[model samples]
Target chain A: MSKKELIVREEILGSNKKVAAEIRGKMEAAGVLVVNLLSSPGSGKTTLLERIVETLKPTHPLAVIEGDIETERDADRIRRKGVPAWQITTGGACHLEAKMVGKLLPEIPAETKFLFIENVGNLVCPAGYDLGENLRCVLLSAPEGDDKPKKYPKAFATADCLIITKSDLIPYLPFDLEKAGNEALDLNPRLRIFVTSALKGRGIAELARYFIESRVNMIQHQRHA
Target chain B: MHELSIVASLFEILEAKARENQATKIVRVRLKVGKLAGVVPEFLQTAFDSYKQDTIAAASHLEIEEVPLKVRCRKCTAEIEKEDFVLVCPSCGSTDLEILEGMELLLDKIDLEI
Candidate 1:
């Protein structure tokens, strides 16, 4: 009975990281701006996507990849907007992985400039997985309260953009916008903040403008690189 | 939970490494999980215990080393470390900070019974 120790230092998510990197390369090369959205259940992600499609689809080629535990309902919503949308149901998985997205990459239209991945509704798990997104936007609905950034710091800390959704409910709820925004900004100073009420179209145009500009900048950066 | 997926990935790596090293069974596993790595240690341990039952590492012990979140203030160049994720500089109260480490989710070592 000989006992031996093997010091094998490795990354647990190395395989996923490799696949995500490949997906990023392919999408970037295709001139697509991939956006990964993270939020808790009922955070207005689908509504925001609908608004984004309404705003950007006239000029920009848009598509969606919806990740959920079940159903094609989300994809159907986007399809009703006259855009190509595919659904990846994880069955029981809480997060969407790169391999799942990479396998469906070919389904995206060749002319699409923006590909939005509506990640699984759970905030905690999806924050850990990267789906080869050029931009990661975390949504915090007004009804969800202000302590979300402090409680789930990992989601806000890693996101490139933060969208405060369902602002129409701000008048009814006791949610303090300043507290959440400030805390989120503190966690990630580089975060681009957007306050939006997709139903009322309060900040939808501004968010769409930012996305369009980001896509342009991405293309220019690629050209120069 | 996502911890199950994480543990699955961990076992893949461990099984490959054990096969490479010609180890029949894994005795212990050490993981380095940072404060911001988005992993719950308790859930990870539970998942590890459940997943290792049918594998070669049936009796394996999983050790998790939590790494603190460390950041440097861009305004004052002060280094700070804490388990609580406050990303502001204590001296200057500047939110402009650069992270040094603490985002690690690494499998550091494995002890085997050959």
Candidate 2:
């Protein structure tokens, strides 16, 4: 039989998903709530995270895994917040896969309370790879415009929460907050929306509260089981 | 972009399958790239064009089959094909819907040269 006529029957994502499943199992056992944050470059993901780590310090044992095409700038910023941070540069690749994360497990402590994996600043490829996160948080900044969800529906559809960052710039920019929120909600009806300006300290408390609550809920449910 | 990584993986699979079939080279490979799969066909083509040289698939042709996004409404149990990212059911404006297709990226088949 020719190669073309044979049944390959291979999973497209293949080994990457296998590693992610392993990571998921380990995270569940360690009682860590992993949040994979996806957004485009300059979407304020790093800034929001820096603020989260700074404000939630001692409250949440936060550890961040930063993904970037190049540069340790994000890791440096998060480290300044006094939390353990690991940077995974994809060389020239666009997204972070579970295998790459699996390699960094040695650097991550087992007692991590909340683990945040900031995927490479791309809306597309990151949506396909799961890093065994408890929740997928997708961000859309005001400057990125409202047509994001319409253009990249899968990302919004798979997100557990939709965060609109740089809200302080909304007045200065042509960002349609309602349209962005509605479009995201249309894809994920149950998605929680938060309008935040990390720089201005706006909505940080609410966002922090949600994170803390989610952690507590997960812990309680785990104990009950 | 990220399509290069995907093409690399595809080549790996193609080579393995060809070896298993004891074929000298590949003739054609078919892929199902879903609308929601996040792969740009143009990028994949460009990547494949450049990376296929000197490999078993150097002369192999790539065939991409796009899968439309389909959803089943949890409220009215309606199955509808949606081109847009919105999840509303056409029959009923129910927000609850389950994805049926359009998220898959799979290697469908490969033609081998003996």
Error of 1 at A214 (Å): 1.1
User: What are the per-residue Cα lDDT tens digits for candidate 1 across B1-114?
Assistant: 699999999989988988888888899999999889999999999999999998988989999999989998889999998667778788898988888878889999899877
The residue pairs that clash in candidate 1, if any, are: none
lDDT of 2 by residue, A1-225 (tens): 433386665766887787898987787678778899999999999999988888787766879999999999999999888899999998888899898888887678867888899999999879988898878999999999998897888789889999999999999988889999988888888999999999899998898888888878877877898
- List-wise, what DockQ does each model earn? 0.78, 0.64
Q: Which digits, one per residue and each the tens of the lDDT, describe model 1 over residues A115-222?
A: 999999998999988888999999999999998998998999999999999999999999999999999987887889999999899899999999889988988999
Q: Per model, state how many residue pairs clash.
A: 0, 4
**Candidate lDDT values, in order:** 0.92, 0.87
Q: Give the candidate number with the greatest lDDT.
A: 1
* Minimal lDDT window, size 10, model 2 chain A: A1-10
Give me the runs in candidate 1 sitting further than 4 Å from their true place.
none
